[model samples]
Target: MSSAPAFRKFHLMRQRWSQLLFAHWPIDPALLRPYLPARLELDLFEGQAWLGVVPFTMSHIRPLGLPAVPGLNRLHELNVRTYARLDGVPGVWFLSLDATQPLGVWAARTLFHLPYLHARISLTQTGDTLRATAERTHRGAAPATFVASWTPGDVLPPAQPGSLQHFLTERYILYTAGANLQQAVRGTALWRGRLFHAPWALRQAMLTEWDSTLVESHGLPTPTGPPLLYAADALDVWVQELRRI
Candidate 1:
């Protein structure tokens, strides 16, 4: 819905995202600038910048037209992200992505140039409540940990075109810089990947416990005050090829 993909249909993989919690906090745009590639413009909503800590489950992951491998298809994923734009197109810019699967991390880093790090993570759900935990265990990487629990409440319709919820959750493109990847690889300037998914089935959510070092891991200050929380129902996704942009 960010105006980039037209259901392009030529995807690299198919995956499902479920039991997701989107936790967001407003931040000073200046504080996030140093961490972004110069080529990207930090995207803002009414002159404000936001950072999100998202915990979700990835399952049924497999290459296009291939069957999912039994052991490797499911993973626990958590990411810290901010918004950005490139060539007038808006998208997400990841600060870090921690995953439970080692092979999945390697494939994402090498193929998509994302900042995918290895971590110990788990997720559990019962009725309308979910609990999640994560700790970065990748060798030589900055240590970051998160623990949280929440209950989904009051199903909401898809966000309208101009609403804050739409700005915060409906991103369909993502940008990555090879040099900024976790392992310090160099040379590629910038890359963009487009994805296609249906409108999110959302629910208002309440977080009983919210604590993380994900934002601080990038040397940014811990944001104060309660965060904006939303829970999304499962959506199947189509990830297209990552191309230098």
Candidate 2:
């Protein structure tokens, strides 16, 4: 019998507003330093349903978007988003705005339609490698499942012909129930290729539409393809290696 609760929650609060505003910021340590949260928590879920919470904060006047939202002209803002998982799947997310300000509770209940947060995770360990299966569900319906396979290896190494890229994972796929969605974005990326690549500014501008084409081909409705979900920051190189688990 499974005794674990069904959901994990993380509450993100903001101290200083982040300057970057555009969505889908690549996972970069330096660029994300300004917005990195100070503290957060993860709670255990139990029973027919499960709940978890994490608390963190952000800054005002983020660099990437519209002007900061001001309420009572306070220097800091406090809020929390709860995650709830049911049936071992991603369930719902509820956001509580203005925890520190007056009427914050009323605003959270009336203005936004925040739902309970949830997610289902399964892990398998094979020798030195681990495989994680993450599923997202809405109501009783499952949205998508992301399977990640990881193992300890060098960050950057030379690429050989017909070899897999080491900087990225073996593969990332989406699934629904037991059926493969077939709507998966698969590609081989080598960050450290000895190729003439543009600087960050030029690369960002030129590769803006790369995601759109890549994801759309896989039956996804992404106006822009999903951004590169890098695991580490400022990783400018790729390696090629595959070891048995």
Top of the candidates by lDDT: 1
RMSD (Å) of each candidate, 1 decimal: 3.2, 22.3
Model 2: number of clashes? 43
Worst 10 residues of 1 by lDDT: 179-188
- C-alpha lDDT of residue 153 in model 2: 36
Candidate 2 residues 127-231, lDDT tens each? 744444433332342244444443433333343323322212221111111111111112121011011111111111111112112112223333333432212
lDDT of each: 0.87, 0.24
Q: Model 2 Cα displacement at 173 (Å)?
A: 28
- Positional deviation of 110 in candidate 1, in angstroms? 0.6
Question: What's the C-alpha lDDT at position 223 in model 2?
Answer: 34
Model 1, span 29-148: residue lDDT tens: 999877787778899999999999999999989887788999999999999999999889999999889999999999998888888999999899878789999999988778999999
- Model 1's alpha-carbon lDDT is 0.87
- Candidate 1, residue 150: Cα displacement in angstroms equals 0.3
TM-score of 1: 0.93
Query: What TM-score against the true fold does each predicted structure earn?
Result: 0.93, 0.22
